[model samples]
Target: MPFVLYAPVKDGLHDPSIAKQVTAFLSKLFQDDTTPGLHIEPINNAVDPKVRTGRVTQMYRAVLFKLVSDGVPHYVFTGVWPHDKAIEVASKAVLKMNPVNGLPELIMASEVDLTPVVERVARVPVASVAAEFPFLEYKSPGLTLAGLTEELGLDPDVAEHAWVATSEDEVMELAGKLGGWRGEALLELAVGATIADVRISLGMDTAPTVEAEAVEDEQLVSAMRTPTAQMQFAWLEDQEELRRVIEGGDLAAWRIFLHPEQRKYVEAAYGGSFRLSGGAGTGKTVVLLHRARMLAKRNPQARILLTTYTRNLADGMKRSLRDLDPSLVLADAPGKPGIYVAGVDQAASQVLGSASRDELAAAVEAVLGIGGNRATSRTSSAQKAWRDAIESVGGDLGPELRSPTFFDAEYDSVVLAQHITTLDEFLRVRRPGRGVALGRLQRQAVWEVIRSYRSSAAVAGAVDFGEVCAIAAQLAASGPIADHVLVDEGQDLTPPRWQFLRAVVPEGPDDLFVAEDSQQRIYGQRVVLGRHGIKIVGRSRRLTLNYRTTAQVLRFATSVLAGENFVDLDDEATDDTGYRSARSGPVPIRVATGSITEELDRAAAQLAEWLAAGAARDGIGILVRDQRMVERVARGLEDRDVRVRQVSKSAATGKDPQLMTMHRAKGMEFTHVLIFGANADLLPAAYLLKDLPEEERADLLQRERSLFYVAATRARDELVVMWEGKASDFLDAFTAKDHVR
Candidate 1:
């Protein structure tokens, strides 16, 4: 009855069988530590007298450290290992309390030998060593060894080891060797985090006040309770919770352990709407899922709506929410009093689906200035409608204004965005982010085109999804649908979608929460949230710690947007800076072949090699530019006797090396990725760029780059990019770096 058990979420619990055994052991231990089946025994000659080993199975044992806090026994389950190895680890490892931060840290008695570094340094000339020493600058001022150890609480020995690192890669390797807070601290410092920044990121700045001279166990237990320490250590609440944590293994670790920076946003109480922005894999969506659950738990009756750009991603978030807490009640409709998950359009449809015919007609009149039932209308694509309007009524317009791209954008960016109905209103509205200027005569021509499109849509009773969203916003104004709305991939939402979301949820405390990354904006153009009545001024935060991709892959992915600029929802210039990955892997490999056939052959060989090296077939992806390229590459792989599947709407459900378009690759990650058709013409996709104005053309290029960035970052461990003839101009960013393989 006096037991408090904690477990460190380590990386080795991937085996389902071992996970089950560990789960069973934890259940028995938590229920009663005295259970003989646990075989909980003290390790002989352990460095720390508290160290012990408990039997998890016949062959495996759980290494634990037992401490007493206020007359209660507390155990820390370090990891699961084989019988002999577990004993060895328990005897040599000690859970030490960090003196400066007053937090507990896991340490090993054995230290990495610097003999290899010394020998390598000895072989190099003094000048060469000075040039190659990655951390030589650390010897100066605030970044010195003493500064890291005495000030930041990094283990002195680990700091000394990193001081001798010859390259950045060596420092990363050393960090891996000295795992735990020390490794993370070193990694943070190496990635340009200042000493104070490291403290803040580690949550030490906000940690509970600790008595340095307090009883050792009491201090340890207190440290274990800090948000920073919980990133690696957590207590088991019940057998079911323990089972979820262990059985979910490394893949599900995000649900259990959250970075201190992430935890702040997930639990913070906002007075109004807040925006969370980050790069790919920075855990924005993770924060949304956690925050949704936290909000639901706080008020069981609160109607929380969780929505995203596409139905597929919304569906995925629903599953993730369920995984985080199966007890959560998910609602089938946005108006229901529970956490509702659906795509933005789907949410709009749900609202409109229940509206009366008169309400629907009024909503349509409000949006398009036309009275009709949009549900019964023959829906047409926005592009086709724009083309038909341009060809029929935009004849007098200049060659520049005659483009469907320009007209379609004008309608979204100015017309629907501002709810402009009449030509006079359209001419008066300010057009922000519409690069090309329009004179009075040109504006009149554009209005004529818009009028033509509106007339045709009215006669045919056709409405685009954008109009539906606008209509939903109008209908919801009379009665809001949700008490709270959480949006993911907010960057991809059109202005109409933003208005609909704003209308669905009343403007108040915790009304709207958005998770987006402008750098991953693959669908819609830049939208200023304030223009849509959503104010996040001084209420926005960014995440820079990428938890998904490796540092090398992150570097490669970010380079694609090197010169491009982006703006946030606030309309201020935003940048992709301060991001750093905790892990490091091989630099991406890029190859240029003579023809499409040769490129396919190279991709096939690499895919085959990964499969041969034991990578799971389902864990590898072949991403191409378009669906056509997806089919083509799939056929190429099939021709080579390589079994493959083409996936859309969702990630591959089965094995056999799936292929998909770059757009489909968003919100997914793979252990290995092969971008098979990255040629210059195919990437910018000549068809999309032809006959476009220079500024509009440049905008398309940015979207293309973002698409490539998404595909490149989807790779978790390794990435291989192949092209026929000349590679895409995006590859030029790769050649500038030493990572070109």
Candidate 2:
């Protein structure tokens, strides 16, 4: 026998708990009746025949008739109804199959009979029925009058009329008049009234029309109290479960999932230049990675060019892309046909080097005012004195001036000025009387040497890395490559690089993507790319969720970055649903009143303990404010038998404990981070005050704040920020504000 099961859309097997119970009940029913076949279906919407065609429906109809013709029992499991269109169709189909199988034995299996089919059948009195329905066992008796009305789909006044009645006869009379199984069930279950009272009240054996005036008054009062009634449906259980998931490291359960501002920023799809400025641990790199992945998904054919200031960063990004998607073909070298990743200066030099040496020399001379053979004539006596002074100095001028051949005009005037400045400063500091009193004479002598040297080499001019960018920009602007250019770390671009980008990219609007965080700017002399024609197309999007650190680590880091420019992450707990950290680590910050040696010992001890506790060696990083500090810390660690690898600006060839200057640590992650020398002089030194206007001071401070933010965020499980005696004033602000515990 085949049985069909139907449920109210609102009461269908959507809830897992309810579905489990229904499945169990049907299994038990089938176990006892081996001859009857049961079919279960949900009736949320009618099946569209177009989806399957006539052949499919005919097959089902034919199978059902064969079972009936063979004297096999079949059953339709569904809610009781009075005027159910589905039931009507089923009844007609069954009648055509066999005359003896009439009505298919109607069964009421749900708590409420809101269907209209019951009224068309005889109004069976409750007293006459000996067997109790299965649905009544699941129904709650505590359901309020209003709750019952909603659950049973009845007019409040009509429900109230039957609810107030007392006897079974009256309920049956009312059900008969109402003319439906839905009306019968409403009176029986919701009103708790018997059939006797329903029959007496209506003064008939059939269902009666409900009083319209009474229903209207009841509905008005119900409407006024709807909000309070609706509050009951909020379902605190579901809310508790959701909160548990979020607090248990399932971060995706939080409202908005990603930060709301971040979603808006990404959706804008701003084609022009857009910069995301934040401190180190603020998910800037994550946003960049996600943006790159998103762009690849959107425009698979468009080639992406990612250039960082250093080769390490470029390699890290390339490795990250591979980790993100193994299928994404990445070239080991930058000049590949797909996504190109390389150092910014390397890319500029490669592109510019294609030009002829004479053409390149002309461009360099135009910028630096070198060569052109327009030398100022000097007397023989002055020339003799210049040669005599150079011989007396006894220093190698070629190496100092960066000249390969003595008379080459390719030697830059800037290089000459740098050499003269170094010699002058050396004389002032070490040998005070030699050039101090003879200032103009000293300057004239330096110029005389430069002129004579240029005349010997026959070179017109030379261009350094900066000039290469400018020249390349001009070359790319006129060439076919100008249509698409993608720049990374665009915020740290110098004036020349900006000019170079402007020269290569076409005017009036170009497809440019700039990924940068202003807070990570360690160099005080650089210009933000946006200030030089890299128009910001939309608001900066923040990637607040720290995929790299725990809440405790992020808390201490954010505290250090307290400023107007810092965007705080949503404090909702971590999402630990999919992936979770195995061990909980302590928040890493230490105060040391001892000397530099003591600080290094304490930091190394902590690193050893972290490693002992199962942290990977590659996951450890040591960050310092400058290269001098890096060298000091590296030497100190080596003395203690710690194998420390110093990350050079030029190459990445070492292992952990990777010693990196804070400037180079941007866009990288470490499982355990030890920040050394957070003193005021090193962190926000007086050097940052040089050559800056008053208005730019605030910008510098913000940059400092961002630097600290970045340093703090580098840790995944443990973060140790330590400083010597008398730490930076910035530390006081964070500690006093209880930003770190």
Candidate 3:
């Protein structure tokens, strides 16, 4: 294992130019790599006597371990800290190298107490579970500390940590807090999780450790030498990649490190449709982009379509894909493509011809058998529009029949999205989540409104966007033009959109690769994928580790979705279990102010604090609920002499810290995010709750909460949630959980 100096630590060096010093040292140390040239000097009173220190500058120190690994001298740079902190880190007397990942970590020798495990070793039996409420095992003893250590494949230093603890409770607590694969498995067992096969499923069963007396097999030697994550030590194969990493500083680590979970999905091959779904920030999109590139490299001539639900996200993907590999053929503009990077609507227009709302309006006028200029389509719900169509034709409409919003939900969310065409289909459609009772007569009245609208559209020759996508799907199913189609943010696309995607590429091995998480679906649309001809029963995978956001923010975001259930495209319950983050940061700052002015003042203060802490202006985001606040916040920032920019959906990419709505905040991440004006009425939109029943409004409220969750996760380091005038009711759930009974 050649020592890998992380690129990120360069940013904190006493001198920025110290990166060059470290680079030159690494270049020489890894010159022969196998036989080492020694510059590493021992730090007195180091945690593990084997660990040594390397010089970066006067103020910064590098803690590394030089060991004869797998019969070859290898150097592993474990960490970079300021001089004092570096000494403290090195003073942690024990080093625990993960057998599975081949990464070395340190814990203070004094931190662990082995008396609990050593004393109780024979008295307690650690089985998967006890038959009678497991009470006996919790209070009693388990197997020997040494015996447990051997089964978990832990090294001597790590094993010593448990031997010092005397209580079974302490042993279990250690497992929960331990950071490696070994502890992960032990924690699972302690919690009574039924792991099917430890060796294959969990990867806790690993190669022999260095402290072991004998190398059990010939293969174990090579396995021990190679690190799974590039973030750890690996023989640097490309000097240019190394140089780029050094020059770019910290962000370079993101390009190099692939967590074990992400690596699994990125490198896997399948014989049929495949999907990767998980909680937000779990790196599903990372795998999607990587897998797409891998396939492109394997088949250079193959045509690939990288698609998503929105133009903004698609554009973002295009930028990231270019960064991943610039030479790969990819779409440049919306329709001008080498290989397509497009939104579903854009793709549909490319294949089935574009239809503007105006054209559709004209077509509807023709269907209405009218010759005058077509009436302009006002922004309104589909149900209201249907009602208007009937009224325009002088049709009698009863009171119950006038529930335009409810019927409109039926049409837009169910009918058009599902591509339901016939009256019989409409009658049979079960709107399970509609939250309003509609009897046979009511259904008939709604059907009459829809029927009249469709007839008028037919007479006027109007075709809506739904028909455009249906046609695109039909055309795509006819032949295979693109060799592979990859989708990101698959959660937000409607059913017909998914059908169109399924049709765009002929079903085959490696044909369609999708990454999604239903919990992040801000649009509040759900589609059963199997019904749309996409089968992923055994082909779907969920990633649990979140690498993007801090654990503090992730916990709050997760709690927002707690007690709610979401479905994947295939109608399967989307699982968010085991989703976690290793990075820890400050708890989100929650502010409850009595007025908007006070909320803005507090938010501005927080932003100023973050800016003072060295955050880039663009890395901060102030997400609001609407355009009025967008303007108000911009003026407020101006008043405080903080340069600001208001970013609209039309112009999202910028260097200035952005001010936008939560809806516009999707597909974006910032280091510091301030979400304000999340008052219940504004977030769910007053229109959704105007006349809706409590049951119907509840569903919308959940979406509002989910929208906040998305905004919360955008913060990589810090999140601040603020509301004026008693705070949004959404805070009630978390408050109840946090308060003592």
Candidate 4:
């Protein structure tokens, strides 16, 4: 029997044929490494004599480094490639343990070429280059160049190559090519981490004493079992696990490679409610999924509700949870003792649908203060009732109060939030976030408007989703519905939805887990969880290290919110102070054209370029501001002979390039993203800001900025923003003289 450890690929493993071949190879290798079909032969003249290539198929091969541990044969499978490429990789690759961190790192010995780096540096003054590349500043007596080579275990040649880089981008390019811990270390240093900081980040404080230069390979094998090494390597114990990993590919890797910070949150036992906040791609949702699994595995009969703000995201989470662990039961109802995944609206519908007619009527009366036997149905537009109400009874209201937007915000944030069902209760409400204070007479007028709205909705037998949620909260408060509840995309959850979730699961140990980022709150208003009965004051954590988006993309995404102040669920203002990225890639591309047609043409051309460069159509996304633009862009792309499918309430099913509105793109990621129609009039959508008080207008603009940030951060590797005429004011952050600073 042989021991096999699999290394994850940074880019996803998407080729079905290659995946099948890798699966076959791993199965055979686990059976017997000496099997002739595997062709596990050592490379001739390799950097490490133990480096070898195993046959995957006639045309493909797997790169492995052979080792012996406790007299048992062990093989570390790095990746699979074409036969020639595998041979080349095997010739140059070596597995060595980092002295500072005591973690095994795989690096190519023959990858660096000093000639081009030195030539690039010669064009600029050495002092200027040194200042531009922070890695060059690690020349202190405590952390000297010699320390980088000897103490830190960096290859002398590679260290010199990085030190002579002329710019941060140049070093990033080098990091991309190096592709391992060496690249990771160089990236951290280039983005302003001291050598000592890198060590600490890698858990060097607990450095083991495994000697790197031990004559026997057993010591090197021992180093692979270290905590830091486990982050990058995982042992495949059986054929079933290997097959699952081979099939799951990148997602399987995500399940295995959680950072220490994320692992802490996932594994921690909380006394009550907890909140996890981070920017997009900071692994907040990842932690949620892992935590759900941990809780389920700990108690097999626990009834958990894994939910989010929308149906599409919730559906996606259910699928991902199945992938993470298939044996965990999935329940359709609340009390079935399994993870029930649903959007908040769906959950509310389930709760309401299960109630008796009398119970349902009482619940509706509790929320709306009216009696009707008509079952609630989804409305074409929740705003339509408000518009009708304002038209019929809002005659005496001032100009500002005439808008349906004003009524919607006031009703949800104040009326529904405080459970106000009477004229006097509405009049006496504080209306904290209402921007403009209302007089007693004005409050009476608003109550009349609300009454009219409720009457009309009752006559039509249609209730808005928010009302459904409020009714569900009332119905569920009679008894516990779930043992535990987990919320993703929590910032976009409104107060009623929060109340419903709180009522679904009683307050107790590990009762509620919410993952949110205030900067991505593109849909709902700012909600304070404490006000909604789910307190997270003492049980909150923020994850600042982004693992999904590259540093270049992260910087551009974050710049959109550079000066805007955002509040977490606790209502405390938050900052992105310690936020950073674990990887680096090319800067985002920005294009401004004279007309929408030209913008569409340029976007189509960029798509062609990416396709020609081997990008997958399924991995590309074109995000727009509105559903109309989504359809228009899909038509335009079709006219240009590009395959595109418009995404609405569900995840795009096929592999054709997805065209979605910015709001629809939430909780989704892509390899390359093109945010289209980011023009001056389109992004804030003109209508949202047309007729509003100054405070409301400012708040709406902040939400729009958050929407843009969410869309921009979806791209994992590349981002391109296309606009007609002038770009959105949000892009001004990238245009100012000191923008890059």
Candidate 5:
């Protein structure tokens, strides 16, 4: 037999000395027909065909199962086990190739009897959930192998075995045990992926799908090793590398495998524009990055711009790029199309001139008639000048519709965003994004305040932050800068920023690809792409399988925003219809701290439980409303010797429990998340509602809801929502009764 070692077997090589022994024995056998003490004999037919057991140590035995690829036979060491358990492991081992990615993978065949479980399930065929739980669609009684096959891209044999022997719970069990993309595929199905989506994600329908045919034992033995992702057994080419992986115990490879549909988003070419919208943890960013690497590989000479809303996220994206493909060189990472990953501001500055926040603040002060900038407020907050200016009118504009917060959002997000400078232009501008209805007369009155605010800025020779984006967009439209542009967190960018992004990239096939989840848009910056000349009308797709967060956590997180309609980048209503999670965990723990002492004690106790339960110090995360809470909780955890990794301006991924402001937890996931100090005062955030009219306060609360959703979804397994004194009204509303009163 041609000797080979699979990743699974290498991963289980916990002891370096024992691994070296296996290498020595294998090398000796390869040299001749046998080693001094090594004995190889075919296992019984009740287990796998032509399976041989090699003694690794006095107590441990490893299996060498013969699998054929491309009509050649190869002996692969699937895994090692205790000598007594070798027979059991071999009896249930699966040596199969994934039909989706057409990659090979190993799965433990089930040894448990299914007859009892199937009988129990027969009592209750299928328990249907409410309409709110749209994705809970599996009807258990008749859920057949064929039904699951259409969704999981499994081989007929694999699907038949699974359906005949599995229960709903077993689906999740096999998913986790399968490992790699096979596990991911099964997990997606458990979360309610449609057959079409599963097909697309697995790349099963990408082109002509290849289904490996069964090869004879003799034919398989001569076949060369073909190992790629589909959870296949990755064969090492270097002896040193193999030795290091087996002996050094550093076999954690950072390879990202995408679903076929996700692959389609990365590889397909739209005739013009394309956009992808999905809930958080649906792998949108993964698709965006893969698309970037895909384009880079397609043409080494191409330059691609991958931009996000903030520089922090751009930096995060850069780190992910390196992890996904270390060979691809960007401005920082060394290797071709040579990607330029940065915030939208980096590209915006090229067109609008690079003015620091201090400079922008000075200009804003001059425009707002406040003299040449002495305020601590930064340039990004310049949009506040308009609100302060309008509210300066006091009761003159009347109380009925004179809410400064409402007018500010209307003018900043819609008016200035629309680039309307005159009263006539404002009158004719579309107000689709405006939440409150405004008649012409109400708008006329609002315009008077805007007109006065404008005259002050015009006379003082100043400009606000909004004007910067407007000017940048105008400048960019003059000439496109890059051949292709990919945007992450597109939902957070304002209309003007979207326009600028559109202007920077000339329209063409694969020119622009934006991935966003409007439900996670904490900034409340909504846009209709068509308004910015970036049309994604019929070229948009939505992903529904969530890879992070447990099913219980997803249910709770999504429930926070239930019944509310959200708009996608194209301004069409985005439906999270089939969005679901496969992994199950405890429903989030909501601890109401009756007193401040109870609050602190409760949080500390929860952290203790997680640490004791064997969660990685780095895997557990604690999130709070703002930096002040971050300091308080982080120090508290430190007092207990719990290492805390803080996410901030100078954030770095560290091997310790993470503590961060809920805002900083965006696009991040952890095994355990303790949302600390969810008190009423802390939640709406003193800053969120302190300045807004009571009538306009709902929008702020909604923004807080989105922020809460983002933070809650960060937990992959455990979630604890803790509070002191009266809980936030949001917390109450979220856990409200499901049935109609």
Candidate 6:
């Protein structure tokens, strides 16, 4: 008969030192030839032949099936598994089996300490043994066998056999003898014997089980009788206590509520794909960072892929990750498994190579009727001449070309028209190819156009950054690079981008985590991850806690998003540990005159005051609607002797005034915020009045709402919302309630 040794320890399997010792002990037993047919399987970290991880439940289920199928009298080790449900299931499976012909003798080897099992079972100690293990230290010296039996409430005679093992060899010998008890008999014995009884029988004396500890911690003589009254009264008292703690922080409470729910969700959803959709200031990036950290801890071998629409955001995320864990190696992490942070086109181009880049540029230039070498003065003149010839050939340049808009203001109409014509031609080239090859070329052309518009260095750098996603999607959908694709900002993706992501990932719901919120999309675009067969596994969870902003800041900002799907924490009654509030900060919102000069003066004055009050210059931000506005503000602030950092989409460097467009300010926090150009055409016009359908118009409105949400929440202690001309239409509805003077 195979014997079973039940060694329960206080620590869990996560302890590397303890786990190693357990593995060593098991290895010794399995290696002994006398222990025939004894197979010791350490399930933790043991890879499944099919799956890559040894996930506890899967292994236990396999073990039960094998026990029933083979009917071998083998010895199985069970100590490292964590979840109680898995243990319960395994125990019940053993009870159901007929011991004579089915199932093996299970030996649960643990550090001679039984505090963990005692805590789990809420029982007392019954036995003790003097065995030296490097990982454990026994605190209760000179503990007697009689004392153990009395503490556990176990019958002394039945518990006598528990202390039979004096050394490692004897423990193994004893484990083999008790391995094969029948189902009903084992159940009866387990129920009759408390953890104390088992410990005394196993030769441990001073083990304090769960029941004993509970008795020692709480007095048994409490006068309260009714359970409901005790529970209700206690809950009310706890709430009152929590309210006091929250109120003490005053305006800084919201940041405290930000992490708990986020951590819980990430823990539950670890190693799986799911979407995280929320409005701006809902802690999406915070959750993503925390999720990355947790995933790093759980699956150390898995690589992490972090990509964003812009190069700046990607760089920012990489910096933030480094801040969170300095030792993290981004290059070797999982899912290709390390950190590859770049814009979508940059990533795709890296994979697709120069041939694709050249083809795309050629297509873009051919369609635009521009010279191939537009970067050169000669090539630029040639393009101008070619555009004039096209116009001479009756190519009616549209009204948009003749009349300048925000984007066309800096360039001549003929030049703009040439680029437009080129884009149209490139689209036409890929229209017939339609499948994988066409998609790749179309994607390449999109990026090529953007690159050409943005830079003179390469065709890929001339087009606008937005077009990069379109091209990457094409390559992902139908090219060799379509094996595994991960996308961030799923909500901001356009329809074509969604199609591209769908075409790349493997066919299943479990393969993707589409995290996007319709309300938080500030780009005014519509793309559904689920519509394209991406499996959305669970309900969208709301992360309403504001970790970056204080209670006052959260209140003012959340008021704007009020009727939308959001969770508003009473930030005034919460606490965010380790974050300090500005000592003499003004109420976050400020309304000033529409004049650019007047606004700049007031902004400069406020900034000087903040700096004098000890706010770090680096922590202050001046946000605007466009690059032109940024330059205007920078010049105004610099003239006043206030050093400024200008962070423009195009400029890419510098540390004066931190002049940033509203979109780039997402996922960043500032101690003080000064928002300029809240005027109608500038604030909402960039997105609101485009030549798109009514549905698209509504989508833009939602995006605008989210954009404002982002701007308002960026302020940790102070916020100022100012405008120059007619106020934005977005503020009209809110302005009625004295929100703006």
Off by over 4 Å in 4: 8-18, 32-36, 39-53, 58-61, 66-73, 81-92, 109-161, 177-182, 194-197, 211-227, 247-252, 583-585, 650-653, 736-741
Candidate with top TM-score is 1
Give per-residue CA lDDT, model 5, range 459-551, as digits (tens).
Answer: 555555455555556555556667788999988887767777777778888888999888888875467788778888899999887778777
In model 4, what is the error at residue 561, expressed in angstroms? 2.4
lDDT of 2 at 188: 39
Give the alpha-carbon lDDT of every model: 0.81, 0.46, 0.63, 0.80, 0.66, 0.43
Better of 1 and 4 by TM-score: 1
Poorest 10 consecutive residues by lDDT, candidate 5: 219-228
**TM-score of every model versus the real structure:** 0.95, 0.49, 0.75, 0.89, 0.76, 0.50
Instruction: Name the candidate, 2 or 6, with the larger lDDT value.
Output: 2
Misplaced by over 4 Å in model 5 are: 1-92, 96-105, 109-171, 178-254, 332-337, 350-377, 380-388, 391-395, 399-408, 437-465, 632-646, 651-656, 690-698, 732-741
Clashes of each: 0, 67, 26, 0, 21, 67
How well is each residue in 1-741 modelled by candidate 6, as lDDT tens digits? 322122111222233434333344334443451353233333343222111111323222112111111232222223344445333333332212111122212222232233332243224322354335110112233334564355433234323433432322222222223322211111122223333433333222322222423321111111011121111011111222323222323222222223334545554542434666554455576566555666566666544455555567767767766655555657522125545556544554443342365655554354334434221122223233323332443223332222112122112212222233444444544221011232444334333433344343234233332233333443444433322234556555544344435544555323444545554567523433444455554444554333456545655565565555421111011122212111213345557575878777778887888789987777888788767777787788889888887775566555444668888887677888888778877767564355333323444556666677678778877887888767766554443344454
Q: Which is the better candidate, 3 or 4, if ranked by lDDT?
A: 4
What is the C-alpha lDDT profile of model 1 across 1-741, one tens digit per residue?
445455553433435767777888888887878888888899877888888888887888888888888887788887877788777777888787887876778764344354665566446444454464446344233577777788788776667767776555566767666655666777777666777877877877655455756777888888888778877777666677777877886787788777778888999999999999998898999999999999998998999999999887888899898888888899998888779999999888888889999998988888888777766423337778888888898878888676777777777778888899998897788998888888888899999999998888888777777777888899999988799899999999989899999999999999999998888888867889998999899999899878788988888888888899888788877765567787789889887789888877888889889999999999998999998888788887889998988998544567788788888878988999998888989888898876677778777889999999999999999998888887789878765445444
* C-alpha lDDT of candidate 6 relative to the true structure: 0.43
Q: Which residue segments of model 3 deviate by more than 4 Å?
A: 1-148, 154-202, 206-221, 224-231, 234-237, 331-339, 353-409, 412-414, 417-465, 652-655, 691-696, 736-741
lDDT of 3 by residue, 200-295 (tens): 444434444444554322233244343342323334444455555555565545555665567667777788788888887877777777777787
Prediction 2 global C-alpha lDDT: 0.46
Instruction: Name model 6 segments beyond 4 Å from true.
Output: 1-212, 215-258, 269-272, 296-303, 332-336, 354-487, 507-510, 537-539, 558-586, 649-657, 686-698, 735-741
RMSD of each: 2.5, 22.2, 7.1, 3.7, 6.7, 21.4
